[model samples]
Structure formats: C-alpha cells, structure tokens
Target: MYLGIDIGTSGVKAAVIDEQDRSVAEAAAPLAVSRPRPQWAEQRPQDWWRAVELTLDALAADSPAAMAAVKAIGLSGQMLGVTLLDRADRPLRPALLWNDGRAGAECRELERRFHDFTERVGCRPMPGFPAPKLLWLARHEPAALDRACRVLLAKDYVRLCLTGEAASDRADSSATLLMDTAGGDWDDALLAACGIARTMMPRLVDSAEIAGIVRAELAARWRLPAGTPVAGGGGDNMCAGIGVGAVRSGDAYIGLGTSGVYFVANDRFIPSRFAGMHTHRHAVAALYCQQAVVLSAGASLAWVGGLLRAPDLSSLMAEVEAAELIPAETPVFTPYLGGERTPHDDPTLTATFSGLTHETSPLALVQAVMEGVAMALADGHEALIESGARVGEVRLTGGGARSTLWARLVAAALGIPLRLQPHAQTGPALGAARLARQSVGGPLIAASGSEAIIVPVEPSLREQLLQKRALFRRHLHLSR
Candidate 1:
C-alpha cells in the first residue's frame, strides 16, 4: 500500500491505496486559519503537524495493516506559502498563506528590481506567491527572518517534521518566483532580487524522487515502518491533476476550492507574457502545466452564506439552485474577496454585489455568487484557450464540485462538458497517493475518461449566461 497526504488550506487529508490504485482507506482533519487582519491569512505550522497526526490516527483506526504496509509516502499541499523555521525546525511565525495579500508593495518592488521577470519566472510577482511574502517578512518581520534557518513551503515543512529533511519539489518551487521555471532550478538573480540568499532554500528534488524517510521516533509513534521512503511529492494542484490522470498533454482539470483554477498539462514549458497565466513545472517530471486562477471561488460563497445566516454551505447551495432568476434584473457578483490572479494580478481588489435592490431575494443573491464564480472560471478557461491550450473537457474538483447548479453554471459559461470524478473532492490526496505508487513502479492509471453524467451546456441558459458573464466582467472592471 502507498500513503498519500495532502495538507490543504482548510484541512489535512491522508489516503492509503493498493498497487492497483484502489483506495484502501482515507481520512482527513479539518483546520482553521487565523485572519488577524484583513487581506492577511496565517496558519500555525504546528497545526498542520497536529492535523497530520490526527489524520494518521484516523487512518490507523480504519485499517492498521494498511497503514503499516505503506511502502512509500507522497505529500502534497497548498503552494506559495512561506513557512520559516528556526535552527531547531520550529516555526518562527505564522506561515503566510497563498491567499495572503500583504505583499502587494513587495511585488511591485520586485518588478521594478528585475527586468523581464515574468519571462524568467513564467509569471508576474503576485502577492500570494512566496517570494514577495518573504520580501514582506524581510521588511516587516526582520526578526523572524534573522532567526530563520530555513525557508520551506507548506508541504516541505511537513516533510521536515516527518523525515527530518528539508527539501522541496520543482512543482512547488516553480511558483515561488525564486526559481527559473523553465530551467527548473533556483536562480541567483531572482533570489537577489528578493533580497534573499540561495542558502535559505531547501534542497530541490524531482516530485517522484525519494526525499527522505519517516524518522524512527515518529514512525514508532504513528505505527508506521521506520525508514519508509517518502517521495518529494508535489503541490496540491499538481497532485490533483495527477490524481485524475491528467498527466498527458492537454489533459486538464479545474479546482473550485477556497480558490479556483483551470489547469492544463503540456510537455514543454510555455509562459505567457501578457495574459497573466501561470506556467509551472508539472508534478510529472519533464512535463509542465499552465494555470489561470480565481483567488476566491467557494470562499466567496462561504462569505455570502455567513452574511445571510445560512446554517451551512450545502443548505445554502440548495437554496441557490432552487432560487428563481429575476430575468434581466439579476445581480452580478465579482468573486474577488481575496483579490485575483489571472488576467488581473491586482491583490487589492475586493468583491462587490452590483444590481442589488429591495426586490432581490436572498436566493437571488446566492445565485449571483455561484454564477459569478462560474463566470470567473469561464474567463480563466477562455484565457487558457487564447494562450493556445487545447482543452477538450474539464474535470471539476473540490468542495464546490458537489453542487449540480454550480457545475451547470460553469459548464454553460465555459461552454465545455465538465466532468466530475468519483473522487473529485479527494483528487489531490488521491493524486498524492498515485505519485507514491508511481515512485515504486506501480501501473500508471489512465485518465478517468469522460463520465456519462457530464454537465453540458443548457440551451435555455446559454444566451442569458453570456450576458451575465459580460456583466460580470463589466462589474469587475468597475470595481477595479
């Protein structure tokens, strides 16, 4: 059996799979973020470790033999967060998360410092990325920087705690803006641009390479075999792609979690200069992928649910699906609660609900939020196509994928058949498991091909959706 662990923004997940790619057991532990200030998201590194422990304990309770038989471990997590460690591998401060927008000024300074930076890094310096976050720390939290002995990504930090090794994979490092994405290594010039040193970085490795082994103490504590090899693993998004068999060229998937993304794989490195798309190395070695992101997807929905005093997201979504449209008077929502990335790298952007009136019902407002996210995702899909990405179909994954209404909205907006995986919600953790299996010469599972229950475009909603999408864009521009 192979073990795959994904440390996500809101939780930590673990899964055990057999050689045939059958899931033997799976478990997850929920996590909470500390938003002490607006535009800033922080998490305690210890919480990730604790969550991992809880997940492992649950897995052990489910099937101790499967946990013990784990031959290799693979890890995946949220990308672009900075976890500063002291000499003793303790966190210096709360990790700056991928959604944290406190590095906007630093991103601008980075652009001013480096010429042709986007060409080198395959992306512009956005606030959520790690490099600018590090720069922000250097300026605002110099004490933390001075005391730091290593800088690790979210998964790498977990790896250090598990294996006593400090290492990172290319797929995660590619988004740091501290590495040459095309060259697949740290760039000294880029490090200097961020006022950081190369030594601060962990050793880089391939996603499938053996990064380290579970330490004797932790292994004994968790009933895991000592010295069991752990693969370098990948960023959660890349692993999610791998989980759904999106390894080959043009294979793509969309994630609708706290953030939203349209990801497509390619064999060669291709960076966009003006479109604001992100080009990074794939979890699969020698392959690359391009992505367009929506900073807030389900997050916007959650915010609205809280505002309307909805008991939970599921009930809220049900209300949204049943809600009748106002017909030519429906409002448009811009799901930029955490700013945006693709096509607009503005970190200061905030969300808005336009066209709201006394006549608008709570259900209409909920529908606007869902449709807004769909339109945002549609814009990303179109941007990917404009950049020459050949997308046949899209696989929807994440918590948001649970809603039929949202899927239909996205399908109509993007005008593509959207597929839902059997393990759509757990694709990242499953992909992490697949990576662990692949590292040990396991059979490569083919992409879970087209499902019969695809969310196809609704003829009646097509023209109305087009108009709403246009209005969404206009609202985005007006908000900016």
Candidate 2:
C-alpha cells in the first residue's frame, strides 16, 4: 500500500492505495482560513499538522492493516503560501495563503525592480505568489522578517513535522516566483530582490523522488513500517494533472475546487504575456504546465449558499437544477468575492450582481451564481487560447465535477467537451499516492481502466451563454 496526503485550502485529505492503484481507504479533516484583516488570508501552521494527525489517526482506526502495509508516502498541497519559521522551527506567525491579496503593491514593485521578471519567473508576479508576500512582510512586518530563519510552503511544513526535513518539490517551488522556473532551481537575485536569503528556502527535488524518511516513532504511531520513504510530491494543480493522465504535452484538465484552474501541459516553458495566467514546472520532469485561474469557483457557490442559510451545497445546487430558468434573463454575477487572477490580475475587484429584479427568487440567484462561475472559467479559457496555448477536450476534476448540471454549463460556456473522469474529486490525493508508488519503483504516468462521462457542448446553450457573457463583461467593466 502507498499513502498520499493533500493539504488543501479547505481541508486535509489522506488516501491509501494498493499496488494496482485502487483506493483502499480515505479520510479527511476540515480546516478553516482566518481572514482577520481585509485582503489577508491566514492559517496556522500548527493547525495543519494537527489536521494531518487527525486524518492519519482516522485512517489507522479504520484500516490498520493497510496503514501498516504502507510502503511510501507522498504529499500535495496549496502552492505559494509563505510559512515563516524561527530557529526552533516554530512558526513566527500565521502562514499567508495563496488567495491573500494584500501584496498588490509589492507585486508591482518587484516587476519594476526586475525588467526580466516575467521571462525569468515564467510568469508575471502576482500578489498571491510568495516572493511578493515576502516583500509585503519586509515592508509591514519587518520584525517578523528579520527574525525568520526558514520559509516553507504549506505542505513542506507538514513534511517537516512528519520527517524532520525542510524540503519541497520544484513544481511547488516554481510557483513561488523565487525560483528560476526553466532552471528548476532557486534564483539568488530574485531572493535578494525580495529581501530573502538563499538559505531561507527549502531544498528542492523532483516530485516523484524520495525527499526524506518518516520518523520512526511517528511511523509506528501511524501503523506504518519503520523508516518509510516519503516522496517529494507537488502542488495540487500538477498532481491533479498526473491523476487524470495529463502528463504529456497538449494534455489538458480543468480543476474546479476552491479555485478554478485551466491547465495544459507542455514540453517546454511557455510564459504567458497575458496577466494572471501562470506558467510553472510540471510534477513530471522535463514538462511544464500553463494555467489560467478563476480565484473563486466552488467558493462563489459556497458563499451564496451560506448567505441563504442553505443546508448544504449539494442540495442548493439541486434546487437550482430543478428550477426552470432562462439563461439570458438571470442576474449576471461577477464572482470576485476575493479578487480575480486570470485576464484581470486585479486584486481590488469585488463580487457584484447586476440585473436583479424584484422577481428574482432564491432559485434564480443560485442559478446566476452557477452561471457566473462558468462564465469566468470561459474567460480563462479564452485567455489561455490568446496566449497561444492549445486546449482541447478537458478532463474536469474537483468537487464541482460531481454536478452534471454544472458540468454541462461549463462545457457549453467553453464550447468544448468536458470528460468527467472516474474518481475526479480525488484527483490530488490519488495523484500523490501515484507519486508515492513511483518513488517505490512503480509505473510512471500509468493509465487507468475506468471510462469517463463526456459532457458535450449544446449549440443553443452556448449561444445563449455567449450573450450572457457579453453582459457579464460589461458589468465587470462598469464595476472597475
């Protein structure tokens, strides 16, 4: 058995898989993000470690035999977080998350300081990237910056607790804007520009390589063998690509989790001139991935559901699906509850609902939010194409993929077929387990036998969504 753990923005998940790649057991624990100040999102590093332990304990209780049989472990997590640590490996403060948008000014300053910033980093500096977050810390919290001895991403902090090692994979490091993406190593000049030292960064490795071994005591506590190797896994996006078999160039997938991502793989680095489109190293060596992000995808739906006091997201979406709503007549929603990334790169943007009438019902409001997310993803798709990235039929992975109605909307909005692969919601965790298997001499990028359900474009719905998209863009422009 191989084990995989994913430290997501919303929760931490642990999965166990057999040698045949079949899932043996899985468990998850919830995590909350603290938005203490406006435009800032933070999570305690210790909270992540506690959550990991909770998940592992649950797995051990249910599948002790499988846990004991675990050969190797792998990790995947949210990328670009800034976790500052002191000399004793204690967190200096709450880690800044990827969706935090408080460093817009720092992003612009970094670009001004480095003329070749985009080319060197493989994309423009954004507020969500770690380098800009470090610059922000240097300006506003100089004491914390000065006292910091190490900086780690979200998953690496958990790894430190598991193995007593400060290490990360190049796929996660490349997104930090502190690494030379094409070189697959840390860039000293960029570190200096952000007031960070080379020694502050963690040692980097390939995603499928063994970075460290689990502590013997902890392994025993978790029912694993002594000195089990831990693989250097990747950022959630890259691992999701691996889960869906999108390792080769031109392979594409759309992720619809807390954030929406349109990912396409390439053999070489191809930085986007378009703002907010990310180009980073793939989990697989010698490969790269281009991504367009919608900062709020499932997040937007969750927000509305909470406002309406809905029982759950699944039931709320069911209500929307049952209602007979016209596409063009619904309110146009700009899902910038936090901010936007792809095509806009505007951290100042906020969510807006236009064309709301007295006749608008709860069902209409929910439908509008769903359509709004699809339209935003459509904008991302167009941006990727404009940047000369070829996107074909995309495999849909994430929580939203379970909703056939939403899948149809996304497919019609993008005007491309979407394949709903088996075990889509488990993409990142499964991918991490796959990497763990590879670390222990398993197959590389192996194909699955399960077939996918395809959602094809509806021409009539596509035309209607296009009209709604035009209105959506107008509202976005007006809000700006």
Candidate 3:
C-alpha cells in the first residue's frame, strides 16, 4: 500500500491505494487564497503543509489498518508557483501563483535577452511562468530574494516540510519556462536570460524517483514510519495525465478546474510558436505534452452564481438551461472577465456583454457564464489542434465536466467526443498512486476500469453555439 497527495489551489487530497490500484481510503482538506493586490495571487506555503497533515491524519484515523502497509508516498501539485525559503528553511515571502501577471515586464526582458535561444529552451517568455516571478522578486523584493537560500515549487515546499530535503522534478521545472524542452534539463541560455545560475535551482529528478523519506521528527509527529519513501511527482496536469491512461505519446486530455487546461502527450519535444500554450517534458521519460490554458473555467460559473445570488450551482445552471437562446435569439459576450490566457493571452482585455435588452433575465447572465467558458475552451481546442498536435477525442475532468448541459455543448461545438474518466475527481491522486505502485511493482502508469460516454445535444443548438462563439470572437476586437 502507498499514499498519494495532491496539493491544489482549492485543497489537498490524500488517497491510500493498494497494489491492485484500489483506493481503500481517502481524505481531503480545503485551501483558500489571498489577493493582497489585483492581478496578484498569493498563498501561504504553511497552509498546504497543514492541509497535508490534516488529510493524512484523517486517512490514518479512518483505517488504522492501512498505516503499517503504507510504503511510499507520491505528490502532485499546481504548477508555476514560486516559494522562497531562507537558509534555515523558512518561507521568505508569500508564494507567487501561476495566474499572477506582476512579472510581465520581466518576461519581456527575458525574451529580449534570450531571443536567439528561444526554441532550444522549450518556451517563450510569459509573465505567468515561474522564472518571471523570480525576476519580479529580484526586482521588487530583492531583500527577500537575497535572504532566500532555496526556491521550490508549491509541492516541493510541502515535501521539504515533511522530508527536510529541498528538491524538484522536471515536470514542474518545465512549467517555470526555464528548462530545455528537448533535453529535459535546465537551459543555460534561459538561465542567462533570467540572470540565474543552475545552483539557484533544486536538484532535478524523474517524477517517480525517490525524492526522500519523511524525516524522523515529522514522522514521529504524524505517527508514521520514519523511512517511508516519498517519490517525486509532477505537476497536477501531467500527473492527472498519468491518472488517465494518457501516459503514451499522442494521448490527449482536457481538465476543467477554476481554469481549464487542454493537454496532449508526446514522446518528443513540441513548441508552440504562439505564446497561447505551453510545452513541457512529462514526468515519464522521453514524454512531453502541449497544454493550452483557459484563464477562467469553473470560476466563471462561481462568479455568475454569486452575481445572481443563486444558492447553488444547480439552481444557476438550471436558470441558464431554461433560457437557451440561439445566435439569432439574443446577444454576445466576450468572456474575458478574467484576463484571457489562451489564444488571446491578453491581460488588458476585460469581459464584455453585448445584446442585453430590457427583457434580459438573471438566466441570461448565468448562460453567458456557461457559454462563455465553453467558447473559451473551444478557442483553446482550435489553437492546440492547429499547432499540429494530434488531439484525439477529449477526456474531460473537473467541476465543469459534471455539467451534462456543458458536456453536450462542448462536444457539439468542438465536433469531437468528450470522454469522462469514471471518477471525475482525483485524477492526479489516482495517477500518483499508480506511479507509486509502479515504483515497487511494474509499469509507470495504468488505466483502471474507468468508463465514459459521449453526450448528446440538439444539432441546431450546437450550430447556434458555434455561430455565437464566432460572433464573440469578431466582437472581441471590434469592441476593443
């Protein structure tokens, strides 16, 4: 038996899985974020450690019988967050999240400095990446930066707190936009561009390799075996890719969380000419993935529900469903309420709602949020497919995938089948658990008996949604 932990923006989830890939027990603890300033998202690394503790404690309590059987632990976490630590291993400052845009100017500087080595490094400059956040720290928080002795991604930080060792793996490192996409190592030119040296980074390893064991003090505190192995896990997306049988090259997946990411796995490096998406090495050796991000996904629905004062998502979604309108029926909405990340990648763009009339109902607002998110993901799918990646049928995960209404709309608009993995949730943890099983057992990835089916929708509504999406794109610039 082993444990798999996933540290996400929303929460930390822990699952205890047997060698047979059966999840015997599971636990989770929610997390919250703080926005001290607009366009900046920060989370205390301590909160994650606590979440991990609570989850593990709950699991241990639920079934004390599994405790002695536990052998290894695997981790998966949000990507591109920067957590700085002092010489004594204390957090130097709040973590800068993947969604933050404070490093835009720094990203431009990096592009200028490394124009010649862009392709070799595996990425172009982006304000949302980890290295840019480091540059931002160097410029604005130099004092904190100077005092910081080590830098870790969100999951690695939690790992250090448990194991007393600072380390990272390739999958999360690639998200920093600092690695050689082809070679699976840090790019020297990217280092020069960021004015950072290799020493500043943690030792890199494969995702399933043993990172370290839980330290004696922490193990004692948690009442666990001191030498329990902790394996290096990759970013949530890649690990989630592992959770599904998408470990092989050319396998693709679509994840819908607060934001959405469309992923396609590969055995070789693939870079995007446009900055709309990211290319990275997979936790699995010689594998890579192209991931396109949509800035607002389930968040759009949450916002709509709050704005309409709906008590729950069902109520809001029901309202949206009741007022279904065609392109000829109502108006247009550019769903840039949150700064866009995919095809547009525009920070200055704000969401726009056109065609609102005196007859507009709260239902219309709800529908816009739903349809807007669908449109955003549709645009991402188009860009990813256009980039020459073989996007097979979609595999949907996250809160949005639970919407039968949404699944039909997205499938129709994209003209592809959307397969939902059986356990619509905890895909990453399942992936990590599989990786752990492989560490002692056999293969690095596996597919369970999870099943999915294609959703059905009226053909006319599908065409109408597609046409409305086109109209939204046209107005995106004309309104600008």
Best-matching candidate per lDDT: 2
- What is the TM-score of each predicted model, taking all chains together? 0.96, 0.98, 0.93
Q: Rate the local accuracy (lDDT) of all candidates.
A: 0.85, 0.90, 0.77
* Candidate 2, residue 404: how far the Cα is off, in Å: 0.8
Candidate 2 residue-wise lDDT, 1-480, digit = tens: 889999999999889988777889999999999999888899999999999999999998999999999999999998889999999999999999999999999999998999899999889989888999999999999999999999999999999999999999999999999999998899999999888999989999999999999998899898999999999999999988888878888889998899998999988789876668999999988999999999989889889898899988998888788776778668999999888998799988899999989988887888888899999999999899888887765899898888878888899999999889787667888889999999989985555645788899989889999999989998997546
Give RMSD to native, each candidate.
1.8, 1.1, 2.3
Lowest-lDDT window of 10 residues in candidate 2?
Answer: 443-452
Count of steric clashes across candidates, in order: 0, 0, 0
- Reference-based TM-score, model 3: 0.93
Tens-digit lDDT track for model 1 on 175-204?
Answer: 898998988899998787666788989999
Model 1 misplaced stretches (Cα beyond 4 Å): 323-329, 446-452
Worst 10 residues of 1 by lDDT: 443-452
Residue 98's lDDT in candidate 1: 93
**Candidate 1 clashing pairs, residues 3+ apart or interchain:** none
